[model samples]
Target: MADDPTKKGPADRTRVSTSEAHELRYWSEKFGVSHDELKRAVAAVGNSAEKVEAYFRDRSRDARR
Candidate 1:
């Protein structure tokens, strides 16, 4: 099995049919990073599940502001 967390299997990848820009914004908000930053982070971290969860937790904490 492949070890990359970001590499979704064929069944896991779904088409959302949304605007590309909107989708990017949604991911940035969901991941708690700027659009450009998120792209870089995903590339650097390979979208590990654990990393994503940690990002969410950190973002949640910051959201209290």
Candidate 2:
């Protein structure tokens, strides 16, 4: 475990935590999404990073159509 998990990144990189502002910022930027969009992704997919990423990928693929 990191002394400061927020700064070092969470031990569980597979999940996204909206409770931490830093984490919200980190994920949103990482996924090229707005904070609200990231929150919506988490809400829709239960905070699993892989699912959120897939959600975006699917959305992008749909949008390309």
Q: In model 2, which runs have C-alpha deviations exceeding 4 angstroms?
A: 1-8
Expressed as tens digits, the lDDT of each residue in 1-65 for candidate 2 is: 33453584666789998877778777888899999999998999898889999999999999999
Residue pairs in steric clash, candidate 2?
A: none
Worst 10 residues of 2 by lDDT: 1-10
| Per-residue lDDT over 1-65 for candidate 1, one digit per residue giving the tens place of the 0 to 100 score | 23343533322222221125555555666556677766655565555545654656776789997
Candidate 2 lDDT: 0.85
**All candidates: CA RMSD (Å):** 8.7, 2.2
- Kindly provide the TM-score of model 2 when superposed on the true structure, using C-alpha atoms: 0.86
